[model samples]
Target chain A: MTESWLRLAPGFFALGALAAWELAVRGFGVPVYILPGPIAIVAAFLTDPGGLGGSLLATLTVTLTALVTSAVLGAALAMAMAASRLARAAILPWAVVLQVTPIVAIAPLVIIWVGDPFASLVVCATIVAFFPVFANTATGLAAGAPEYFDLFRLYGASHRDTLLLLRVPVALPYFLAGLRISGGLALVGAVVAEFVTGSGGFASGLAYRILESGYRLEVARMFAALVLLSLAGIVINLALGAFGAAVLRARDGP
Target chain B: MLDIVSVERRFARGVVALEDVTLRLEEGNFLALLGPSGCGKSTLLRLIAGLDRPDGGRLTWDRGRAPAAGEIGFVFQDATLLPWASAADNVFLPLRLRHVSRAEAMPAVHDALARVGLAGFESARPRELSGGMRMRVSIARALVTRPLLLLMDEPFAALDEFTRHGLQADLVALWREIGCTIVFVTHSIYEAAFVAQRVVLMTPRPGRIFREIVSTLTPGPDLRLDPGYATLVTSISKTMAAVLAPA
Candidate 1:
């Protein structure tokens, strides 16, 4: 009983906090436009579940595509940098430039250049997500113990073998860490890009729904959309964390 | 079966690590390079192992040319293991690099671990083993390929006395069983005297071979109490102090 209670502590606290929030909103006679209660938000959510769900799915699809693309590109770039000093010197500056440059500023140019709205949004989100993977993986690749290198050299291991077997396995945890960070950032970037690229022709994202609800003074609907996005971010983080821990446990010791 | 003819290794900024060091590696013998820190004992071993090149002289092999790095085994001061891999996989590394699959390399891997007294700890990780056990795993990895030449660089320096003693005895037995040439490097006089048939004392800094002693005392459990063993240890202690003492 105590174990289950401990496990559900966060949920109980959330419910308590929501009850308090709902009471305060009702007691103060606050307008729905100003601060919607939990009940009002749920009612708003039920009124248009299909439309809101579609928008959430669209945003999720864009975020996931960007995340996967960033993972592959980031890993490839990091490996190249680890392999050659020349490549590291040349590519690292550009990657940093891309990472530091605000995606908001670049989104307009990306949308205009790419022509397709979904592809442009993906490009913007990928730009925001790939940096951590590159930086962490690069550090990990260079962080091999010097003694291990000597051991490899003593065995006359080919450079390819050293990189693939020794260096890549060493970098796995670091890459996973980067991927975890990228997961949240990918969602943020997708939402931000959708907010910027609000054309009506393409299927709308949750960000567009939030924008539309805000203009129409449907604050309850906007809050409902936010709940879905927050839940998505939480799921992504928990899933990645569990996966990384499992892999490390299996490879390393208990 | 190997000859290092006046080999000299100089690092950057005119630091002569080894100068005019010549040694012949007698096959199937346990040899120790006994010296103080920075005495280039390790440098000499590296030159012999072809991990480093001699600046002054060349090394010639009995097989007409130097053996390939893959054909020799080396052990470091610490058990340099892949923490992510199991003990068996760690032993399987050199063979893995040679493209031997785990299934194909299983017999050799199992034999190597068993020879080191680690029979059922094949799936155990490095962190799961004790320091001495980790070193045993290291030795197992080195011998898995059954290389003719094994170069060890202060492999047991970090172990406790009891653990060190146990490993020292096992190493001698392993050396005899395998019948391979070993150049064991250590700063411990007792260790050098205990494990090796031949001990070469080296000077500090610009390392040079100061003296060499050949002992016929057979190493076993009672070898530590042998008067001849105490005499050998005492004989080297004076030089060891000289190398370590202030000039």
Candidate 2:
């Protein structure tokens, strides 16, 4: 019962915060144009369900594609880097540079150069998501005990067999951890790129809706879009977290 | 048969681990390399196992023939069982690496596990077993390959006394049954005397064999607590002490 109460505490706190927010806005007679209450935002969400739904679908497509590309390419790069010391030394610096450079600063330039806002946003998101997976996986590949390596050598295991049978399995947990962190970063990168690029018909997303509502002074609609974006980020984080935990549990066994 | 004449090993950092180490082993004989820490006993075993090359001198097998791949099985200090594999899979690893199918190797795997008294634990993962049981799995894996020579580097040093004693007996029984050449390494004089037919004691740092004592104790399950066992242990310990003493 105590454990159950502990689990519900966070939900109760969030409910209390929402109630306080609604009461504060109503009691102060705050202007709805500036900041809409939860009820008004919910009404706006209901009224323009189709438009909001379309934008969400667009954003999700871009984010998921970017995330998948980042994971696959990052894992490949990590494997390549682990296989060759020279490759690691040469490519690691550029990966760091891409990771540290703000997506906001490069989104407009990417859009201008690529001539396609959708592709540019995906590239930006992928850039944001690639580093953690690469770095974490590299570290994990190098993390196995020395005795294990000696055993592999004693068995006359080929380099490919060692990598596939031992190194990759050991590195999976680290890669998943990196993916969990990267999932949220990928979403943020896509939205930030969309905001900067100013989505048109072919590249419209939730960020474009947010920018549209702001310009038209529709506070409730802006809140609705913001809520949707936040929810997307939460879902991505939760999904990746569950995936990582599941892999660990399965490997650990019953 | 294996022969070593004046073998010497020097690390890149100029620390000599082994110097002028000469030894010869007959086929089907059990030998133990006994020494203090940092005495290069492991380096010596590695040299024989072809894991390391001597900086000076020669090592040769009888008839100038090298053993085939997987002919020498090694058990390290730790069990070193692959954490992800079941005990049966781990035992079958050597055969599998040699491209033997699981079906072809299953009987040998079962016999090896049975020899190590782990018959019912074929499907148990390494993590599910205790430390001693894991070591048994490692032994089973080594023995399953049916190697001509078994090299063990203090395989039981980490286990408690009861488990270590039990494994020592199991190992002797297995050796007798298989009639394979065995070279065991250990820092424990008592363990060396208890398990090996001949114990080779070495001096500290830049290790060279200081004494070779052959035991007359018959190979049996209950030879450890025999009255002669204590005398053998004392003789080996005294030799070890003399070797480790000041020059």
Candidate 3:
């Protein structure tokens, strides 16, 4: 019985916090422009559900595309690095520069160069999401036991055979860990890129909606869009977590 | 059957691992490389298995050509199984690397597992097994390829005495059944004496063979209980102590 209640505790706490915010906003008679109450945000959400939903769908598409592209590219580059010391030495510094430099600083140039709003946003997000997968997979590919390497040599396994049979299995947990971090970064990248491009006059996705609502003094609508954005991040993290857990459990056995 | 001809291995800073080491192995003979830690027994084993190249000298096999990949088997001090894979999958690794399908390799895999006394454990993972059972899986994987020579580097040093004794007997039985040449490296004088027909004693710090003893015990119910076994162990210990003492 206590366990069941404990499971519901987070939900209850969230409801209580929401009720307190609503009561405080109404009790203090704060202007909606300054701070909209929960009721007002819900009312704003009901006003334009289609618009909010459309923006959310747009953001999600960019996020997923960026994540998938980074995952493939990052893993391939890591494999190349594993194969050769020269490639690692040549490529790592540039990858580090791209990662450390701000996406905001890069987004404008990307939009100008790419000349396609959606594609530029994706490129920006891909920059944000690529490093974790590459760095983690590189570490994992080298983490196999020395004994296993000798065993492979004794068997006369080719480079491809050793990679597929030994290194890949050994590096799986590390790859999944990188994937989880990159999932969250992908979302952050998409929204930040959208914000930069939104000001450049591409009026698509939730970040644009947030900026437009703020200028128009539609504070409740701004809060509604913000809430959807937060919810999207939460859902993405939880989904990635579930997927990683399932993969590791399968590998670890019954 | 292999020959280690004047093999010399030197590490960085000129630290010698093996010095002027030469030995001849006959077909179907079980040889024990008996030595203390850092005596380069493992290094010698690696050279024999073609995992390491000697700085000087060569390994000449009976076949004129060098052993092909998967032609020689090895078991380490630790049972190194792929923790995520099933026992069957681990055993099938050698064959699978050759592009044999699981269905095609299942018979050899099963036969190897059964030979190791781990029959019906095909689906168990490494973590799910006991220490001895995991070692059994390692042995099964090594034997699945039917290698001509088996090189073991203290393969049972980590197990308990009870498990060690049991596996030792099983190993001898398997050796007799397969009739392959085995070079077993161990620090334990008694293990070397019990398991091998010929014991090659080595000295540490620039490892070189100091003594060689050959004595064969007939397989029978009373082999371990025979009075000669204890005498053999005692005499080998004396020889090892003399090597450690000053001239």
Error of 3 at B178 (Å): 1.2
List candidate 1 segments past 4 Å from native: A1-8, A200-203, A249-254, B13-15, B101-104
Candidate 1 Cα deviation (angstroms), residue B6 = 3.6
On residues A80-107, what C-alpha lDDT tens digit does candidate 2 reach at each position? Answer: 8888899899888999999899888887
Docking category for candidate 2?
A: acceptable
Model 2's alpha-carbon lDDT is 0.88
How well is each residue in B54-102 modelled by candidate 2, as lDDT tens digits?
A: 9998988996887766888999999988787889999998888777899
Candidate 3 lDDT tens digits, B1-247: 7788999999999779999999999998999999999899999998888888899988888789888877788999998899988999999998888778989999999999999999999999999999999999999999999988888999999999889888888998999999998999999997888889999999988889989998667643345787888888988999999998873
- Give the higher-DockQ candidate: 2 or 3: 3
Model 2 pairs whose backbones collide: none
What would you estimate as the lDDT of candidate 1?
Answer: 0.91
> Candidate 3, what DockQ?
0.70
The lowest-lDDT stretch of 10 consecutive residues in candidate 3 chain A is A196-205
Worst 10 residues of 2 chain A by lDDT: A195-204
Candidate 3, TM-score vs. the true structure? 0.93
Q: Where is model 2 chain B poorest over a 10-residue stretch in terms of lDDT?
A: B238-247
**Which sections of candidate 3 miss by over 4 Å?**
A248-254, B101-103, B219-224, B245-247
